[model samples]
Target: MKTKRRAAYFFTSLKLFLREYRLFVLLGCLCLLGGVVVGVLSARSFGEDYYKLNFIFELHSGSYSFAKTFFLALLFGWGGLALILLCGFNRWLIFPAFFLVAFLGYRLGLGFVGCLQPSGAGGVACVIFFYLPLYLTAGTVFIVYICMVFSSICGACGVFSSASSVKRLFFKALPLSLVFAAAAFFSCILIPLLYKLFFM
Candidate 1:
């Protein structure tokens, strides 16, 4: 009964948070999409030169390593969560959070282009099978963290205009962030295993 009550409260808090900060969430999504489009266009325009210019492309073009993929995904997930959590203390940190999301999206764009170059339809399938889950999980975590940070900043700035309100917002965001973090970490860990099973 206590567990059920806690679950109900969690859902209620989440619903209120979404309603209050939907615009910030939308902005986070747009930033990611915008970054992806830019990356795609840059790769298309620059071709081989772009591959040379971007170290991430070099990393992607190399042989696949389960250890490397696992580590990087772990870093992307938990590291991003850490960064977003820190952003709550200073508004300036928000810029880094935004950049991190956009940068991840850009990396995804470059990777998608690379996948298409050799395999065509098979490449698309590879992305759907392998990359999509990892990136989507990371992206969800990032968007939520970004929103939480933004909301915290607003609360600090008196946008919420009440100490109790600010505290309530923090409490709501804290558990949600932790939940997403765990999900991101597990999803990332699963990706390398999935790749090894199917692609390797």
Candidate 2:
């Protein structure tokens, strides 16, 4: 009887948390969808190195061979992360940049992008293996934490401070973005290094 009651209570608590962090949950769901889409599209385009989401440029042996693949990863990963953050206005990001990039990239008819666009084929993993799972987790953490902080601050300010909705939103987003960026960045490094240790 106690076990069943405890389980029910735990689930009820979980329901409360979920209700409180609905924004994070929503962002998590969308980012998850984005990851799968990113992963699949990457595999189709990058072939073997789809795992690294590099080899699209910098060449295994070419003129810019000294530049390395890490640059590609950083560049695109940062862009994608920022796009996910700044533009995620309640859905699919509120900006045309993300929309256009996602569409222009994803809507190439499900084939390989390297073949289609000369500058295509840069990508990375989105599937749940480990470590990288925290990429989404970190982002979601930021989302939830920001909401909590934002609400708390607004409440502190009596909801009628000189701060407009835009100001409040900015406060919520900027700090959260920075925190998430740090977590995500570290995760990206950690994932590759950890994977390398085990596999390579």
Q: Best by lDDT, which number?
A: 1
What tens-digit string does per-residue lDDT give for candidate 2 at 1-200?
99999999999987997898776556545644565477456656665432222322323223223224334434544454444444433332333433433442342222233223333322333223322443344445444543443343333233334357545654655655565555544444454455446644
TM-score of each: 0.67, 0.39
Could you list the CA RMSD of all candidates, in the order they appear?
5.8, 8.9
Q: Estimate the lDDT of model 2.
A: 0.44
Summed over model 1, clashes come to: 0
Local accuracy of candidate 1 as per-residue lDDT tens digits, 146-185: 7765665654543245566556655755665566555544
| lDDT over C-alpha atoms for residue 147 of model 1 | 76
Which pairs of residues have clashing backbones in candidate 1? none
lDDT for 163 in candidate 1 is 66
Clash number for each model: 0, 0
